[model samples]
Target: MDVTQVLRMNGGDGDYSYSNNSLLQRKVISMTKPIIEEALTKLYCAMNFPKTLVMADLGCSSGPNTLLVASEIIKSIDKIRLELGHDKPPEIQLYLNDLPNNDFNTIFHSVSTLQKIITNPSCYFCGVPGSFYTRLFLNKSIYFVHSSYSLMWLSQVPEMAISNKRNIYMSKTSPPSVIRAYYEQFQRDFSTFLKCRAEEMVSGGRMVLTLLGRQSDDPCSKECCYIWDLLAETLNDMVVEGLIDEEKLDSFNIPQYTPSHNEINNEVKKDGSFIVDHLEVSEVKWDACTGYNHNLSEKDTQGYNMGKCMRAVAEPLVLNHFGESVVEEVFTRYTNVIKNRMSIEDTKLVNVTVSMTRKG
Candidate 1:
């Protein structure tokens, strides 16, 4: 599968669309706001107050959270300008980037809504469609960059010599060779991503990246593997019941990897283009809302809610592999699996947030 063409969140504002079911992603954006503010503040001071600020939001899936991020950045910069008593506000050029298949229409159509929230006439928006793995901006053109919940997706699924055997991602049963293959693929993709960004960003430009990661060094840890394990389990059950082909189940693998902090740091140091400012790992509840309350509810609908969330991100891939006939049934069984698992024990996803500065 072409990761650039096939890997995208379900678009539009329907009930199962990413725009509606992206509460989890939206929550992630909120969690990283402080990191973004800190990076922007430092960049503003270090750059001697440039008249124009060029920034890009990579992997900006079509959703309310897309503009929400832009609004937050504009608000923070506006606040900083006012505090510093700048007579002229800087013109902000934000490039919202994603794959070509992304619903750019929805994003462009929502500009008025963003205007209602932040009526900054100086702020301008543009849509750049392509893979972030390749260069999207001119050399030394960008002043700041932010990406949330995107880098976890590799450029493509690793080419494995041996079949992963019914598992859609790394698991305890996966062989050492399989694990090595996944890690090596990430190393290449991430290094290329860094090289491209290093060329695009100006010296001392700041970047804030937040992505799903594992707390332990083990790639098969529950923090990163459980979700896909449950998904594979559901598919296995379907195969047993003759609902899906056994060979197909054995062949399917997700083009995603959750790296540990050590792994990420190694890549950054190896790339030799950026200096790490801050790196942290935080836990977010699987179905937790973005409010003061942190408790997981026992609501019966939580299972379906989580199912929809997963569907929003994974449906397109599933449809491409298994056909649309089995999409609903697959997620239905997956939801029941999540509900049962939640009843037994609370589950959480680990998120890694990192801030970096381009080396001068």
Candidate 2:
């Protein structure tokens, strides 16, 4: 299956749409604000505050979080411009980029609201429909780049990853070859990403990228691996119940990999086009967006909300593979699995934030 054609967050403004359920991603964008500020500040100075700042938010799924990143960038640079007492703010030409199937209409329609929120720097918004794994802009055109909760998705699932069998993602039971395939796929995709961005961004261009990541070198660490593990277990349960085919369970694998901080570092070094300026790992609770109470009684609510969050992001891919018939039931059971696990341990996600500059 061509991942570019099928993979996208649930769109529109309904209950399960990414626009409504993306608080987790919004929190991630918020967490990376300081880094964004610092990167843009230096880039603005390095470029002598160009008249027009060209920027792109890669993998910008539709939602409040879509424009939230733009607002952050504008606010960060606008603050610096004001502090320096510059009479004019740069006109910001921002591109919102994602796969072709993303809800670009929602994003375009929301710009009026964004205009009310941003006063200066006259931002022009346009949606670029394509994969970030390939070139999406003119050479040396973009001055700044930002991506959040996106890079962990590989361009495609590694062919050998299906050999992982029963498990949907990297787990303790995955053999060495499956683990190696995932990492190798990540290395290739990340290097290609860096190479593409390097050509598109001008010298001294700055970028801030935040993605789901792992703290431990072990690819199977719970922080990054458990979400998929739980979903796989849920699928296995369904197979036993005769709700889903066992062979179908064996064939499906999430086209994502959460890398260690050092893995990110190694990819940057190997890519050779960007100099890593800052790299850090931070952890947030799985249910960070929901005001979820940990009381035993509140478990069901937490489970329901968690399932909605995951489904909002995963539904399209899941629907494409498993069909709509099982989507609700799948997440319904998956939530119970998560709720049960919550009773035993706290669930958290590890995020890796990297700030970089294009080599002149």
Candidate 3:
């Protein structure tokens, strides 16, 4: 599918109440703030002089997480200014960017709520709508760049792999060819993303990125907390039910790039532009105590209530495959499967957060 179609497929003002919940994302924001703040301090110290700082958050989806990141940057700058006792700190130009179809209205509303705290009229806020794989800012302008839970979505898979009709991504068994194709596309998009950002960032600028990743090499293996097997099983059931065409299934992929720490280090080295300053993988766990609690263990009525929370991501993909008419039934069966599985013990949702920074 083309970019426009892909956006349309994923676009909608569904019940994204969970995505906006601050409580759940707060933990993540708090955990990542120290690392980002440290990077900023190092960058400023290296410059050895006060200067205008331009920061951009690539793929900043409309949610509390976006604002949380922006607030962290502002606070860090404030702390630095106080330490040096500067009468006036350098200006801050903050850019929030995402796909063109993102909910800019919600994002703007969130920004407005912060107007009281971000009192400086010199502090600028702008919305940049575009793909991060391509250019998003002017050359030699940005001082810091950060992205979270983004980057894993590639622009598109390799064309050759799609044309081969190998069904590498979705077959009765594991398909290494499909896995390799996905990796190649990730590498290309990631490389382009770095190059584009490099052009916009000053020579001494720093970048901190966090995204979903895996530490294993097995295509079907488990890592951190993401269970590909469960997801595959869910999709396979749909295929068997004739709700979606098996051929079309291979046409689209999640495009998640779960690179190992070493692989990521190597990619940075190959780029010959950014120096790897910090690379660490940590487990991000989601549990019942989190916001918008959804699981199979809930009673049928309670589970349905929680299942409504998942429509944001599921509805689009399901609608694209099986007409919109089947959404209710599809979701019903899907949720039922979860409820059934919950009877078993030891099931949890987990993700890996890979944090990296560029040389300043």
Best to worst by TM-score, what's the order? 1, 2, 3
Instruction: Between candidates 2 and 3, name the one with more favorable TM-score.
Output: 2
Q: Which should have the higher lDDT, number 1 or number 3?
A: 1
TM-score, cand. 2: 0.96
Compose the digit string of candidate 3's lDDT tens values, residues 10-32. Answer: 23244534343334334655667
Q: Per-residue lDDT of 1-360 in model 1, one digit per residue for the tens?
A: 888889999998897888888887888899889999999999999999999999999999898989889999999998888888887889999999999999898999998789778846888899999999999999999999999999999999999989999899999999888999999999999999999999999999999999899889899999999989999999999999999999999889999999999899999999999999999999888766322223545565666677788988999999999999999999999989987886677888999988999999
Give the least accurate 10-residue stretch of model 1, judged by summed lDDT. Answer: 289-298
* Worst ten in a row by lDDT for model 2: 291-300
Ranking by lDDT: 1, 2, 3
Better of 1 and 2 by lDDT: 1
Error of 3 at 253 (Å): 2.3
Q: Which residue runs does candidate 3 get wrong by more than 4 Å?
A: 3-14, 21-26, 119-121, 160-172, 224-229, 292-310, 336-360
The lDDT of model 1 is 0.91
The C-alpha TM-scores of every prediction are 0.97, 0.96, 0.83
